[model samples]
Target: AGITGTILILGHTDPLFLRELLEYRITQTVIDKAHGIQLDAAAAQAGQIPEVHLKIDSGMHRLGIDTRQPEDAAAMFALENLNITGIYTHLAATDSIAGEDIAYTRRQIDAFNGLLRTLQGMNIQIPLTHMQNSYGLLNYPDVCCDSVRIGASLYGMGSKEPHKSNVIIDLRPVLSLRARIVMIRTLEKGECFGYGMMFRADRKSRIAILPLGYVEGLPRKLACGRGTALVHGRRVPFAGLVCMDQLALDVTDVPDAKPGDTVTLIGRDGEEEIGIVDVAEAAETLHVEILCRIGQRVATVVIDE
Candidate 1:
């Protein structure tokens, strides 16, 4: 775990969290507003000067100082307690090639560049500058800077659908979700199963119970045959309502499926692969949301390959 790369926190700053960051030697963080500047000043008064990157609100309207008021950010360079190492902005809609969205992203880039020129006119030299998030880097590679802030793309995921973006990278997924089949049983043709008996077997069927459900971030929307899992290298449909900690998969087609078999919920099995995007599609949400909602109870194993 000796990763010595710079670990910059991209979230907004607060006084209490800033103190904790300083205490842990994580001296670099993003300053999105005047309040964040004050927090850094207080830390300086306490004998710690945290390196910070000023974030300009280049049309995201979510965080960062306003682009119109470059003076507000220029004033921060005077504060000895805050070492302004970098400056950046977030591009709101760089993911879409739609005419309006493209124009909007161009405007954001222009605004951010305008701010940088203003700061340069004041003779303020920031060591690093960047504005590209994952989508921005992919779609607007010409808008380059010292570094880029990539999130989803780092995990081998970019667009919800490949057709939505102009640039596509052959990225291999670095994460997988798997569950063990705890039990397997046969359901009679007329039998109902799960909460509210939402699923009834129309044929004599074999089902495998997995110790994973909504509590584990498996969307309930996938219940009642709407979702599938890979068992013995074949697809198996969800057979009943997904419970708090359990769900049943119709494994009748995979006659070799049995208790203790591995279920690929979001990963590969033999020639079959269930990507995170596939899970997100079935759950009617974004793949990033699916990745973020994975419960803490689920174990994460990092494979070095």
Candidate 2:
């Protein structure tokens, strides 16, 4: 961390004591700022230190000091007590499934490069240049700088396999989403179920209700009025509009359904598996967006079998 006086800190840790860990960068600039901090001064007074890094917006435009204004860069250097270590940007559509946004991705990279040129004229040296996110690492290798940061793949998720010479490691999914059936109704020839009366009985049907629904992140787009679920090793189309806390599926074929029957919302039953990607394709969206929006109310069960 000290070789460059920059430590990428995530979450909520104070930067005051960080100076001590910057073993390689003990320059006076860092020492002075470390001591100047009002960080419970009396306690840290004995160990005042200051090696720091500031985030400059290259193109992400999400967080960091927007360098669009030269003053933003100037304001950062003006902080006499700190050292600017690195600058980075996040590409917006590098992971596009269509791969049609290559131009946009390259444009952002060019913008960041422009910022670097602008800073160099002002005598600012940005030691680390990183832009590649998981998507960037996979589809836009040109954006990888300093190091590559990976996330979705760490837990075995929707990352595209990169064609890089370095073998990409495959991670295992650490979670499984499961649910239980609350009730099973015998649908008479004219019965209807769920919100908006979306599912009408097509011939005496057996309907099973699961205590999970749109509230749990099931795509409401299923309102095309057709959806399905995994039931007893078979696929059952949803009978109607997915509700807030429950959904109904036609389980007539799965004659064994009962109040206590366990259902697989996103797993395999026998030789059938319902992955989120399949669900996303059906809903016409990327699996990443759908996974990110999964409601917090659902229990995240970690199982190994």
Candidate 3:
């Protein structure tokens, strides 16, 4: 937690947001999306500009000026009353080692580096430059100039499927999602469960109702028997459709499960662990998406042991 670097604000911000940033004295910002005109207007309204980092479009085609276009790049960099403290870009892909996206990532880094050299030759010095994302930092550490942005890796999600990385850094996932079983009951054979009565009890079934649902960021497919949770250190299958505020789980196998018992949705429970990647795979989505879908209503309880 002993972080001692500037927190860069990425993307264009509204003038009001910029004013708030000024009021808070948070001035280290990146002007990655603004052209000369937008920067002038926003910075004028926000008062004195902070240390600015120019964003260059090396290849992503999203934000940043094309440094290859000399006239355009020069015009933006030469704008008055604004300080250009650094230059940066975003890598499109660094998760691949053999695809065109990987090759394009290298090309983008090359172009950005070349632009830096050009700027140096022209006596325009940028104090900092950062182009690497989490994947880029792991795969292309040498090219990660000035600084590296660690996004997913900061949360121990550094790679895609298989959830493995060759990076030298040691990472341990620390986030976990937990819920409580609010109700437990026994269902007779042939009894229906949940909306549309999608799941039918084949035998005497012990079920547990959890006060968690898609609204709380649990994947809806779980209710369709796609995902599993751990209770009493045993695996349990989800039953029927996930409702707006509750989900049912087949806990017949988890003989010890009961009301108020803890459930591990995406976390470790004894020897069993359900990771973000695991949930993503079950939901047919990305790990980042799974993480972001977590609703704001859920309280974040941190454990630092």
Candidate 4:
């Protein structure tokens, strides 16, 4: 935990949160709204001017000062005691390769650059400027910047359909989700399993019970054979409805699977792998959401290889 690198908070800011940031040694944050500027000014009056990066709303319109209103940003920069170290904007549609999306991204870049030029003419020089997210960096590498914000791609979980992008990188996944098989049993033909008897075995089937379910962030949408996991180096389908704290896998094909064997839910196991993107698709969500929704009960083991 001895990380000496700069930590920047990207969420909305307030007076209380500003003080909390200082206590935690988080000195830099993104200022995206008029309220944020006011908070910084108030902090300055209190003799603690926090380092901030101004965010411009070129097209996303989610946060940041409006691109058309450069005067507001200029005024914020002119405020005394404020350490405005960087400026940035969010690219709205750099994830798509569609012609319309491409043009829209270009317009966003142009608008952001125009604002930078305007600031330059007014003798305002923000030391750093960036406008690229993961897809932005991949699709618009020509739009140079001081830093690129890589989120999903940092975990090698970029767009599942990489063909939609102009650039592709061979990034390896650094995270994995695994669980131990807690029980193994066989259901005779016509026997029902799980809540609501969602699965009625058509044949005598061997299933492995896992200590993971919807409560552990396994999407309920994956219930009833929609999702799979790797057991004994083979893909095994979800055998029944995913319960609150447990689920079963149809390991009839994986005859050697047993209790205590490691089940790969989102990682490589032997020659088989269950990627996060695959889970996302089967769960009808994004890989980002899959990663974020992992329950606190799951132990995170950090391995450096």
lDDT winner among the candidates?
Answer: 4
TM-score of 4: 0.93
Question: How displaced is residue 68 in candidate 4, in Å?
Answer: 0.1
What ranking emerges by lDDT with the best candidate at the front? 4, 1, 3, 2
In candidate 4, stretches whose alpha carbon ends up further than 4 angstroms from where it belongs are: 27-33, 159-162
**Could you tell me which 10 consecutive residues in candidate 3 have the lowest summed lDDT?**
27-36
Error of 1 at 2 (Å): 3.8
lDDT of 4: 0.84
Where is model 1 more than 4 Å wrong at Cα?
A: 27-32, 159-162
Error of model 3, residue 142, in angstroms: 1.8
Tens-digit lDDT track for model 1 on 52-164? 77778899998788989888888877777877788788888887889899999999999988988898999988669988888888888899699998888888886555555
Q: Per-residue lDDT tens digits of candidate 4, residues 27-116?
A: 555555566667766777677777777888899988888889888888878777668878888888888999999999999999999999
**Residue 158, model 3, lDDT:** 50
Q: The CA-based lDDT of model 2 is what?
A: 0.63
- Model 3 misplaced regions, further than 4 Å: 1-5, 27-36, 159-170
TM-score of each: 0.93, 0.70, 0.88, 0.93
Candidate 3 per-residue C-alpha lDDT over 132-200 given as tens digits, one digit per residue, 9 for 90 to 100:
878787788688487777778888875643333355566678889989999997999999888899989
